[model samples]
Target: MQTVNPQTILKEKFGYDNFRAGQLDVINKVLAHKHALAIMPTGGGKSITYQLPAMMFDGITLVISPLISLMKDQVDGLNTTGIPATFLNSTVDGQEQAQRMSDLRHGVYKMLYVAPERLEVPSFFSFVQSLNIELIAVDEAHVLSQWGHDFRPSYLNILPLLEQIPGHHALLGLTATATERVRENLQQLLQVTDENTVLTGFARDNLALKIIHNQDKRKYVVEYLRKNSDQTGIIYAATRKQVDELTTYLNKIGIKAARYHAGLSEKERQSQQEDFLYDESPVIVATNAFGMGINKPNVRYVIHYSVPGNIEAYYQEIGRAGRDGLPAEAILLYAPQDMHLQEFFVQKSEGSEEHKQNEYDKIREMNAFANTQTCLVRYLLQYFGETVTKDCGHCSNCLDTREWVNVTVDAQKVLANVIRMNQRFGKTMVAKVLKGSNDASIRKYEFLRELPTFGLMKERTLKELTRFIDYLTAEGYLQFEGAEFPVLKVTSSGAEVLKGQKTIQKRLEKIRIVSQSMNSDDLKLSDNDNRLFAKLKEKRLALAREAGLPPFLIFSDKTLLAMAKLKPQTDVAFLSIPGVGEKKFEIYHQDFAKVINEFIVI
Candidate 1:
């Protein structure tokens, strides 16, 4: 028996010319039976590190993933590529689980992906003790660290099992988003050495980031989708109702869309996810729950309909787009009120006071990402403790050439009104008084009408004044008291403005699709090749429908574009396309080549 070269496995099985920057290094360390901590960016070939080794290893490689969707996607793709892989997750039934366990015992598998929660099962833990497990790869490995964004207690159970399994076993911890604190924690927990740690700096050249503040979110979404009508995107709302509303409105306007949230049944969520993945629904409006482990590679954009909980979650969510190494966009529709809801969650969440404070600090950082004048990418990278040299020159802030106007008068107006109200009213009432709207709440407080600050800025609309107040709150000019029903209070910063000691330069410009040029689907498709790309996509959809596999599993749009451009007729020519391998060429080469030939004739 001869040992297979990783490069040969790379080109033959996985369909790539070479290992991505940090991939081979991590693979080599793992193959040497050394634990590795790989901090590659999302879509940076982290999977290949463990996957190629799994094929060459003598025993099964156990992959612990947090989400069932990720498990299913990878398993499906690996199995399609002729690498034997399966997942044991909540989605599997008792009979199937039993059968899979039997197969594992018989050494019929090379790699197995399981949710972290499964390690806690006594039967599952005991059954695992008997198997020859060569490697343990923890995907989204930051979950093992409490300091990380998405922490899971179940991840703690992974390392102890590795100790019990007596053998030369290697552990691999994988994550794209890890702060310095989180990275150290993962290294300590996984017992990974510094030499084996591969830190690929976090930067998505294909992804353009945009942060849109103080805009009409619903209106912006509708218009933005209409502009990018042909593209597929994920719209993440902060709540279930928002998801439903956006989905309904998008569909009502003749745009195909689906909604997903915790409110939906398991079967319903699965159907919605499939609809999006299959391209039946080109857009999905979902809460944070929809995208963690999703393996959809061709998502054109990701729009956060509201501010996410933290930069960690936001950065990870945006990493979902442009995964095929194609240009994609990430738009964050943020407003000041969005922060209040997240702050409320942090305050009410189950944690120690220290934990709550840490969460609060994260919220402030997320707010800074929205409010910062620096590069959006720089802010995010800096937050994750990476040094950035310059601006991305493509984010909303960089593209925005709008002049900042002095809003000192407006700030003073808002502050005086808050002070006049004895700092007792929330943003809404304060705005209503500023706009001179004698609503029922105002009538209830009859003394408010005669107040010196009341109706001082009647020139502004209720909405405009409300937004300005929000900006003030976000900028720390005003503070909110209480959690659920917060009231506005003037911060010392606001007092300074009122006293003419400081000035505020506010850029409340309504953010449209500012990155239209940057976000353009400017793929390198020639006019003649564009026709073939469409035809190839049609063939892909047809084959995917027949085989019951995601279209990307057969071939990514990136590969399809290559097939169209090169118009490969021979097996050699076809396999030369990136993402094409011997196994893939054997399965799909002829069918795609036939399509290309037919298109050429037409």
Candidate 2:
């Protein structure tokens, strides 16, 4: 038997010419039989790190993922490449799962993907102990850190499970999005030293970020879809009801659309996901449930019908677009009222006080991102503790103009009202009191009407006043009293603002992008090239259906676009496309070449 080089294995097995930025480093360290913590952005080839090592090792690699959707997608792709991989998850039945376990015991598998909960089963634990587990790879490893966004209590069991495994087995922890704190916590959890970890930059230069303040999001969504109808995308709403409404509206307007959420049956959700992945629908209106580990690389845009709960979630969701290293867009439809929806969720979540406060703080960061006038990418990077001296010129803020508004007077009034009320009231009550609402509660509390700042903001609407209070709260002028009701209380900074020592300059409407150009699709292809690209996509879809694979698995849109533009006539020219490697060229080059030749000759 001969040992193969990792690069040789990569080209022969996975059909990639080169490893992504952080992939080779992580793989090298893991092959050295050391624990590795890798922090790469979405679509950064985090899977290849452990995947390549698994093929080379003498035993099986155990991959623990958080979502079953993720595990199934990975196993499917690996099998498409002729790799011996299987997943053990709740989606599979008892008989099939037992067969898989039996196969694992016989060393018929090189890789196994499972959820963390599976480790808690005593039978599964004993079964894994009987196998030669060479490495443990934890996907979405941020879930193991309580300080990270999207913490799962079940993920804590991973460390204990690893301890139970005998011998010197390597550990690999991987996540697409993690702040500095999250990264530190993951390192600590994995027990990987700094020298053993890889921190790839989180910037996705191909994604164009846009923030739209559309009062009528439905109309905006329809018109935007009308312009970019040829491209596939995802529209993420904040709730199940909104997902259904958006899906219906898009379909009614002659657009092929689907809906996905936890409210649907498992079969329905799976069907919807397959439809979108197979290009049966060009658009999917869904919640956050739709896009964890989905590998469709041609998503040209990701539109947010409502703002997300945190920057971590927002970044991860938008990353689904342009995953093939082509240009894509991310448009956020932001309204001040949408903040309340996330706040409601934060208040309702089950967690400790510290965890709840962490969530609240994340929400505040999200609010700041919504209202920021600086470079949106810079703001995001800074939040994650990365420094960029220059602005990324692609985001809405960098492309638009922003003006500062003097909100010192409004800030003073809001702080004054909170102080007068002894900071005992929530944001809504403070807004109501300041706006002089003549409701029954105001009538019943006669002393409230006697406060000096009671009616100072009567000219402002309750919504406007509440927004101001929220701005003050987010800016550190006020703090939430407790985790339950989120009452506003003046902080030390709030006291300074009230004493006329600190000034308040808010960019309330400063970073507004004109609605006309707001829906611009920034893909740099020409009309003729786009037409040819669309035709190539049809060809790819036909091949995908014939092969029983997703369109991207056959060839990504990026490759098809290249074929359309370059009109590759021979196998050599076809192999030059970015995603085309040795094995892929051997399998797919002739078909793509025929498509290009026919198009050119016609």
Candidate 3:
């Protein structure tokens, strides 16, 4: 196998100076006809693995995608790069489909994107036979595994088609999220040996991860959008109704936002997505369905309005930002009720009891992530089978400046109460007993009168007690017994804590920070500095107006804030802020710096 120069290809064809990390290596292996599985982060250039190889190979590359919009987006993006690409899916009429097949047979397209369902059709199979196939690329390949975080039944049928292809063709699987189980499934489905497998590490250094505690998520979301008005970002909700409600709320607050979800008509979804892609809308409030195939680089943040099912889903959603190798943010808002919602989902799923139990266990593991005091990035990476020594200073936990108190004694007492109550009850009953809540249920059960540990921790609210129990379960001090209406079972750790043989420490809960007054200190600028910053912003707006771009395209608020602080004397120093790239620096740096210099002297 010859080594293809990815840099040369990047410059000549894609107009990029270099390949992102793991791109060149993955592409090289694929070009050599080796079956490969790439575990790249969401914005980590996974597409180029097979895309660049497709350009170098002799035949058309067939890429199987799960979403129809994603296929169209990829096809359009390929065409923009002057690559002849087309897609076959239900979106195209019968006549157009026939013509596309004819085009494929006549060697007109170098890359072809198709949905998995379409791949099962006889006509598509015949077309594949007629074309010289270089490789088969499966995007979101983790969907093929039933054990994966997100499973699609349509993807399960793609394995047999690999054997049906006529010529020598390599297989490439790409996804932002895949655990060890999902990786094994990909190998088995693609028939790739262990030696042929390539697992890229899942550490995304450019993104800062955060989990914010907020019971009133809607208020927090609204305030966040209002404060960060001129940024390109995505807000993910768990349901379509949420997407709609949040979109409407943003509009009510004077933010140009749109909603995307599966419930929307195909045309509506397409239009909304295009508007967002074209910068007609700077923000998109959406469900998980919105971001699979859409590639809009330079997204500065991805905010989760609700907790995701697992770390895998979380990583994939957050991967949408910072694709252009720039800094980005991923924030998650969580509450205890969210765990109950996930538990409900687990109970409602149609599967074997054991399978359901496995899913429930995974959900607990995921919920523990919200309560952890360790490095958020390291925790996420560890879930995906990577090891990191130190905490990432960019995450919320690292930036937090709060004092912690030991809760081991309280935890021991709580466990003792649960044990005294026979371990047959749920978390609610145990919490009520601990908080001295003599509710009807507690009174009927006579738990309030138990002298062993009744009202010992009355200072802690019901919410606090419940959180401690959740932490206890998360840290293995308590376990859930598998039965209808699951019971909380004290573990060995619980026993030790009860006997004073071990100690369990927990951070004292911090008060949730409302987004209303965040950065208020900075919001108060000196009158002179405010006037100067306003002038610089006016100059920026004028340049943006002249150039027909958004104000953010000229400079972000962070950049303006930096200008106020640094009061740069030269263009070089002025361009050093958050979003002032070379292109913008060339356009507005000197003018802004001159304004600052003149104001400072005055």
Q: Give the whole-model CA lDDT for all candidates, comma-separated.
A: 0.83, 0.84, 0.80
- Tens-place lDDT per residue, model 2, 439-545, is 98778778889999888899998877876776676567887766556677788998988899989886755434545411224335787778888888988899889
Q: lDDT tens string, model 3, 1-602?
A: 22566677788778889787788878877887888888888877888888888888878899988877777777888899978999988889999988998888888999998888887888767777778888999888888887788776667776887778887788888888888877888788877777777777887788988888855676667667767778889999887877887787566445789889989998898899988998899999998887887788879899998888777888889999888778989989987777677778778777678667766767767777887777888888888887789888989988877767677788888888887888888888888888888878888976457756788788988988888888788777898876336778899878888888887665656766544322547546787778888888888898888989998877887678767866767543554354665566666767787788888888
Question: How much lDDT does candidate 1 score?
Answer: 0.83
Candidates by lDDT, descending order = 2, 1, 3
State the weakest 10-residue window (summed lDDT) of model 1.
Answer: 513-522
* Best by the lDDT measure: 2
What TM-score does each of the candidates earn? Answer: 0.71, 0.78, 0.81
Q: For candidate 1, write residues 1-602 as lDDT tens digits.
A: 12899999999998989778998889889988898899988778888998899999989899988887657777888999889988888889999999999999998999988887887788888888788999988888888888888776667877787788667888899998999999889889988777888998898988999887656787688778889989999998888988887786566446789999989998899899899999999999999888876768899999999899888889888988989999999999888789888988787788666666667767766775687665788877887888888989998778878788898987888899899999888878999888888889999999899898888999888877876775676567887765345678888888999999999996656545443211224457788989889999999999999999999999998888888777876664675566775568778877988899988888
Candidate 3 regions exceeding 4 Å error are: 1-4, 349-355, 443-451, 481-485, 491-502, 511-602
- The lowest-lDDT stretch of 10 consecutive residues in candidate 2 is 514-523
Off by over 4 Å in 2: 1-3, 93-99, 346-348, 442-448, 474-481, 489-602
- How many clashes in candidate 3? 0
What shift in Å separates residue 145 of candidate 2 from its native position after superposition?
2.6
Residue pairs clashing, model 3: none
lDDT of 3 at 90: 83
